[model samples]
Target: MKLLDPYSLVLMASMMCGVMSAVLFLVRRSFPADIQGLGHWCAALAVQVLATACYSFKGTLPDGFVLPVANLLFVLGNGLCAIGLQAFYGRAQGWRMLGGALGFALVGMVYWLFVVPSYTARVTWMALPLTVINGTQLWLVLRHGRRHFATYFLAMLVGVNALLVAVRGALALVMPAPTVDLTQPGALQGAYLVITAMVPILLSVGFIMVATKRLQFTLERRSASDPLTGALNRRGFDAAYTRELARLRRRPRTLALLAIDLDHFKAVNDAHGHGVGDKVLVRTASLVGAALRESDYLARFGGEEFIVLLPDTDIELAATVAQRIQAALRTACDSGIPVCTASIGIAAQTDPRQRLDDLLEEADQALYRAKANGRDRIELAEQEKRRASA
Candidate 1:
């Protein structure tokens, strides 16, 4: 059987690469500026397109001009891929090492093209650097990326590409080809061209998927978080409450809630302005967060009010946490913020059937009493008569 035209495959690969590069460029324009790596990846694809385009003109153009430029761009494109992964994973891009590798590859390409004119030597020179770059990219994804499908998919694609490049380089040394021209047809050469053409398209798909997943995760986090103080918002608290209730059903345990209202918060706003009031809220949230255990959840219920959910804690322990928050805020006065204190109401539930509304209501009533009695104090909610009867 005859092989498909190698030059045609190279042309097809160049077109596919160009299309993918354009797609990534368009996608990147819509992405947040903080998300790094897409630009690098887009540039990498563009460079690869140019490399393959130059390579396709192997017979038509001067070998000295086309071969060196094509191979140089190929090496640069692979290096850019490694740099892109580094930026994606928030790691330092090793520019010096990449520069050294590019320089070495360029020197080898030049020597083989003009001085020696060996096909196998040129293939080895190009392939080795690409293998290193691809291997580095695979390692970065495995080490820094989240353990998920998108991470594994990208890793697998890069690992396969690296392996192929390495094996091709090894084969070039062991089994030298008859001709120096890339357009020469052979089964191995045809397979390599097809695989190379397909891999970039698949790789672009994988990149888009990974980036989309990150964007989705960021949106989810922002939805659940309070923009002002970075605490959980009411909706976020509700989700947390539901999860805790499910856990409580699995194993019976005490769950406690603390409703905290900032004392004289309005006075702070009136005297110092809303800017100071915002700072006080932020400081109060920080102090409360510092006081709580890892197992606890803190949320901004509304303006000047916060809620804390403590799992495996009784009313006494909840009261201790409330006092710790009060103490933390007491020290905040000296930290260049307006003096702030929180009136806290504590409620604990041993029954898994109790809804969050019931717990919140009891805590709110106790908070009302704490404010009525005197501000800046902790009050424990009286157990319901239904609980006493039970």
Candidate 2:
């Protein structure tokens, strides 16, 4: 096949990438939780767009413009990708920032040295850093390769990068003699356009799809989680509790529920306006969540009230858990709420005959007693039962 002829396969890839970029942009707007990550992805797509443009205008654009534009795009895109990867792994700050800055500086040096000289030197200088970034991205995916979509996307990226490198080599080998035209290449003008255009497009499509889905997932999570406290909202809490109850009935696990109401919570809300009250709620939720085991779940039941679900925890252990929670909340301090305390009503399932409603009823009764007993106390349903029996 003549290297000058356009490859249909490459053209298809370019179209796909453009469509995917649009789709990813729309999807990114939907995710507030993953906004930073989505921004990084958007940056990556911008690079892909630049790459596509470079491929299209290769011979037409001045050598000065072409090499600097193309190489710089790749560098920026790769840098954004690294940042996005770090964000995904929750390690984007500190040393990673230092590393990213160093990488960008090196990329700028390469652009000045190679792209300013000639296309051939530009391609040569571009190879190592491009490979390093692509390889590092692939390694990250491989390390977390169990995710089906991530693996697929990473594979696609690797394939596209390899194609780019191959095209660069072909471009170098097939160019006309120095006397004829330093600007225009003879052998693979058409082929170069096709490959360069198509590769970024195809890779962009895969990346956009991945980024879009991730954005959607992040949106769903944000919908379910309380923004201030990181606990499940009323709807989320109900859904979770219902699911746990249903699961427990099938498997018959020892389950407990603690209904925690902050004493004088309304006073806090009234005294400091809603903002300070929100902070207190957030702090209290954090304290309570920290007190829980990984297996346990804590959620905001409603304003000033929270619910905790403990699987495989008996009545005694549940009371102990409640006491620990009480202590933690009492000690919590941020922006000054004075001394805060929670009145927790704890109930556990001892009999397989009991239902979730029954458990809740028992716990509620215990809570009423705790409030009646003054405030700032943990009262166990089993303890109430003992007193009633006596």
Candidate 3:
């Protein structure tokens, strides 16, 4: 009985906005605090709360102002949301943002001046564009891997609202029937009661799911990552390496493995204390990560040692990569450290008979030789040398 009220639905929508605000706050903590996209989300949620509250107080507003004000606020909230989506996805570039903004402005002006005066006019045209813009944004989210949970949440919102609009549209066509009562809280009133009952349930459930996903990601990162370096810890590294090895088995291809050990690392830890050594480690990791392509994998194997996996790279190319990593680490600056160098051992999947574990052991043996012969140089696997000689 209580579910038939429109104001109840408006209150539920406002509650959803409150939940969204909490999600934005939690997500912001995991990322860099000064991110611009987070600010846009906060602004958009504020507008949505205001719009929903306006609808909740519709009976109290003056006659001419109610419809115009509520719909206008909806337009503002959705428009700002579109802009925020563009920015958050990093697609608000060049002519695309300009074009989207122009379209929003044009439709907003026309709706305000021409459509708001007559209720029928608003239903016939305004609802279609609203559905299209929201649906398009959901499609964009599915296309990009980032913010996929956000996209899915928004898709449910769009679909539910589109269904509401369609049902209302069908009722408008049969309004002249004697059985219809446009003001009643029933299906005869264009199923307003049905939408009012269902929309709040959908919105509330969807908001809860989105907030849960955001919180889960935040929790997983804190538990699985290194606090000082933002790199994967031992647990994370093992999981990633195992997954990569399985994937490599499925698609047979050339793979290069490099085992890197910091030269004279104990001297620094002894001379300057562990703090300086940690700084040097972080700086070295940053340099190596920057030098490699995004597809390449790097992980801290243990104290003062690292491992890198380069897919589709042969031994020759792996040597070149090892050299780049060495040169980059040499030039890398760490606070209160003079200079740092690394000795790297290079190995690759050259033989069809070699397994991932075999490749790793060969890389480890070559790393020992690199440390044995000198402090800072690349050592190739002996089998690789024999292949080249032949």
Candidate 4:
């Protein structure tokens, strides 16, 4: 087998990076602006393409121009990767720290390239900062990224890249090269160049995978949630019910459901238009959400009706929650656009065999009774009678 020359490998890396950068730039436009980081990553890949192009001209161009420029662009690319990861994870970008690090690394690279004139020193300077940047990216992925195959894949690639950079920096101290030219042919140099050529492609694949995972999650969330009120829709409620029922079955605990209906909701819509009605519904959902415990589940059943599932709660405790929601609605009415009150019906599952549909039917019946009895009061569903033994 014949080995490719270092110059050829460098040129290939530059071309590959340019293609990947363009691919990322196009892919980024498809994602929502709120989905941050793709822009930075795209820019990083473009900068890296330039960096490798400069390196490919090492023998042709003046060392003073090629060496410092290539190393600086390389470091800048890594720094941008770190920033992109931070943005993707919804963390502070810390631009000042990044600027300082890049400035410091550039000064060191210039000193080694011109003032001191040591190739090993320049390599060490470049590799060390890359190691730090890649390590930071690895940490962000592990700490903040979702536990998915895509997340772990990106993390693995980044972690290995960081390790390789650190090893290269360490090798510069232990095994100094005879020549200052990066294009010099040797086994280690070839291997390094090969890895440099391949990693950007691998990293881009990992990034796309992660972004795809994020898009999947976002779509799933939107499907399951009410866009107007930000509450779980009926589909989401059904899934939540299944999970809650399974959990309750394991623990042999009570599960309570509260069916809530906004009283005179149509009157509000008729009087103040849908825009104001939307504000009322959003405020009502917010208030109900605040009244419920963290473990409780809230879902928009349809129109002005919402449902709440409270695990490990009896009918009495569920009534207390209902009262709290009513109070919240009353307070909201006093302060906001339109006056609104919610009539709540409570039903509790004492038997593990009780199905979600049966519970929902009971709650709905009770809700009808609440509306019939007054309008803004709570009604408890009558417990089912056990069959008589023969």
Mind giving the per-residue lDDT tens digits that candidate 4 earns over 1-390? 567987789888888889999999999999977688999999999999888878778779997888778877888888898899899889999577678768878888789877888878877777777887898899999999999999999999998899888887778877756432347777777777788789888998898899889988898988999999999999988998889888877888889999999999999999989988998889988999999899888999779999999988877688889999998888774454987998988888867788889999999988999999989999888662121121
Worst 10 residues of 4 by lDDT: 381-390
Off by over 4 Å in 4: 178-182, 249-251, 333-336, 384-390
Candidate 4, after superposition: displacement of residue 293 in Å? Answer: 4.1
Pairs clashing within candidate 2: none
Clash totals in order: 0, 0, 0, 0
Model 3 stretches astray by more than 4 angstroms: 1-61, 72-117, 120-140, 143-153, 159-204, 207-211, 214-224, 269-274, 333-337, 349-359
What would the per-residue lDDT of candidate 1 be over residues 194-299, giving only the tens digit for each residue?
A: 8988888888788788888888877877899899998999888999988898999999899999999999889999998998899998888888999988879999
Estimate the TM-score of every prediction: 0.85, 0.72, 0.67, 0.89
Model 4 clashes, total count? 0
Q: Rate the local accuracy (lDDT) of all candidates.
A: 0.86, 0.68, 0.66, 0.85
Better of 1 and 4 by TM-score: 4
Candidate 2 residue-wise lDDT, 228-261, digit = tens: 7889876676677677767776886778889898
lDDT of 3 by residue, 1-390 (tens): 333454555566577776776676566566543233555555656777776777666578763455556655665555555555555556652235435544654565466556565444445445555565555555545564246565477666756675665655555455543333334455444355445445534543454454446556666765666666666666666666566666667877777889989999999899989988888888888888888888787778668888888877888888999999899888866557746788888888734556667877999899999999987889988988787789
What is the total number of backbone clashes in candidate 2? 0
Report the poorest 10 consecutive residues by lDDT, candidate 2.
Answer: 176-185
| Cα error, candidate 3, residue 292 (Å) | 2.3
Superposition-based RMSD of candidate 2 using all C-alpha atoms, in angstroms? 5.9
